[model samples]
Structure formats: structure tokens, C-alpha cells
Target: MKNIKASMLAISLAFLFIACSGKVQTNKIPNETKYYLPKGVKTSDKVALDSKELQSYSLALEKFFKRNVKADEEKKQDIYQTGIERGYFQ
Candidate 1:
């Protein structure tokens, strides 16, 4: 009984909030999801990136792209190997 009342109140509040906003919602979404700012907030000079920005981006990413990782072979020690060697398998 208590849960039903609480849910009905919540739904009514949500409908009231939506009714207060008079703006029409659209289904279309922008192809570019962002503009250098956090949360994709709109800015004036964020239309497109030129050659200078591209050059700076490449320079910044050069070190990260050049990294190489080498892994050495570790001995294959299974779980049963330890128990058998310690005379606990019996």
C-alpha cells in the first residue's frame, strides 16, 4: 500500500516537471558529440580544427605511439603442482 502511493506521487511529479518545460524535444542528434569543453557544452570558436591544432595533436601523441612493451616467459605453475609437491594431494 505505501509503495503504490509513493510511486504514484513520483510519477505525478515527473509529469508536472515535464509539463512546466515548454520547449519542444527533438530526435535528431549532432554528428560531432563535443566541442573541446567538458559535457559537450557549446562554445563560439569551436566550429572546426585547423592545421595548427592538428600539428600540436600529432606532436603530443608521438611519445605515446612510440612506446613498446616486452613480456618475459613465466614458469607454468598449476594449482595442483604445489599441492602434489608438498604431499597434500593424497
Candidate 2:
């Protein structure tokens, strides 16, 4: 009976260790276009726009892209830091 209880305790502890382990899973595909504008913005795409609208759209798109890139970089950095903290790296 004591041997059976020890075996069960060891199994439970093994499962607890596995459950508590932190593993980071990421799905980041390089060279994949993740953002799109509803209306076409490229010159060769043949989307027409007036001077004022075009200027406004350009500014907005610039800000949007900058914000997204900054956020992505920050998230990547955070993941890297987490990996380091979890002893995945030296």
C-alpha cells in the first residue's frame, strides 16, 4: 500500500511539473502581408483620389503603419524577454 501511494504521488508531481512549465508558442510568418487597406492606395493599382483626400490618406496610412510596426517590435521584445526569464536562453 505504501509503495502504491508513493508511485501515485510521483505521477502526480510529474504531471504538476509538466503543467507548470512555461512554453512559448508563436506563429510568425515572415514576408506575409498582415495589413490591407479597404481602398487601393498603390499608384499602379489605379485607385483615384483627389489632392486633399490623397494627402489625408497618406498621412493616416503612415501613422497607422508606424504604430503597428512599433507595437509588433514591442511584442517581439516582450516574448524574447519572457523566454530569457524562463531560462530558455543563457
Candidate 3:
């Protein structure tokens, strides 16, 4: 009985660990998943990117984008260059 209980406890712990492990789902963004935009960016209307104001807006967007992207996934130089080209990072 003691052996069975120990085995069960170990299995339970293993299951819990696996359940709580870091698994970033890179599949697809659900339609319900809304992105949090800055106060200046209007959610409804299309607004032109003001070069002066773009810095703040870009920073906020970069933060949000970075949150989902894993560090390991950002291993290549292309990713860094693309971000720079797209004006995500300065």
C-alpha cells in the first residue's frame, strides 16, 4: 500500500510539472485575443503614423510583440535586422 501511494504521488507530481511547464503556443492568434493598444492609437479609425509620435507608439507595440516571442526563437540575425528595418527597435 505504501509503495502504491508513493508511485501515485510521483506520477501526480510529474503530471503537475508537465501541466505547468512553459509551452508557448505559436500556432495562431484567436479572434477573441485582443491586443492592448496605447491610448494615442485609436482602435476604430485609421490614423497616419506621425514620425514624432511614432517612437512612443512603436515602443508600446514592440513591448507587446516581445512578450509573445520567445528568446530562443529570436536566435537569428535576420530577426534583429527585420525588426530594425520595420522600425520595431531602435
Candidate 4:
């Protein structure tokens, strides 16, 4: 009976060790840092702009496009005129 009890305890301890040791540990805190470089961009040439700087840059580009949209349309019209003069199509 003592031998049986010792064998049972050994089996239970083995099972507990296996259960605890085989558990998959997850990351408690996620890393915000990027692991890989973006496609088509070199690591040395890249600049890390802050969110506010990016927002301002985006707004500036939007405003510039809005301001020069008419000029771009005029340039397109000139290109069409030149194409017609060159007899690109009948």
C-alpha cells in the first residue's frame, strides 16, 4: 500500500510538472516598436516624423493641392493642345 501511494504521488507530481512546464506564456506587455523596415524604403534614408508633424505636413500638402488645382488643370489643357498640334490622334 505504501509503494502504491508513492507511485501515485510520483505520477501526480509528474503530471503537475508537465502541465505547468508545457504552458505557453504570452507577452504581458506588447512592444510598440516596429520589428521590420517598410517595403521599398531603406533603413538609413527613413525619417521618423511625429504624429503632429505628419498631420501638419498632410494639411500643408492638401492646401497646396487645393491652391494649385486650377494651375494643374491649365497645364493639362496645354498638354492636350500640344498633343493635338503634334497630330498624336486624328
Q: What is the lDDT for 58 in model 2?
A: 94
Q: Provide the TM-score for each candidate, comma-separated.
A: 0.25, 0.29, 0.29, 0.29
Provide the lowest-lDDT 10-residue window in model 1.
Answer: 67-76
Off by over 4 Å in 4: 25-31, 34-90
Q: What tens-digit string does per-residue lDDT give for candidate 3 at 1-90?
A: 999999999999999999899689888766776866788975657768788688988999998887745665665567779899899997
**lDDT tens digits by residue: candidate 1, 1-90:** 999999999999999999898677577665686644587675586578799999999988996776553322245557798789889979
User: Each prediction's Cα lDDT score?
Assistant: 0.78, 0.82, 0.82, 0.83
Better of 1 and 2 by TM-score: 2
Question: For residue 42, what is the lDDT in candidate 2?
Answer: 52
Tell me the RMSD of model 4 versus the true structure.
19.5
Q: What local lDDT score does residue 59 receive in model 4, on the 0 to 100 scale?
A: 100
| Model 1: residues with Cα > 4 Å off, grouped in runs | 24-90
Q: Write the per-residue lDDT of candidate 2 for residues 1-90, one digit (tens) a residue.
A: 999999999999999999889666686556556675567575465767799998999999999777867678766757778999899998
lDDT at 20 for candidate 3? 93
Where model 2 places Cα greater than 4 Å from the true spot, the runs are 29-90
- Is candidate 1 or 3 superior in lDDT? 3
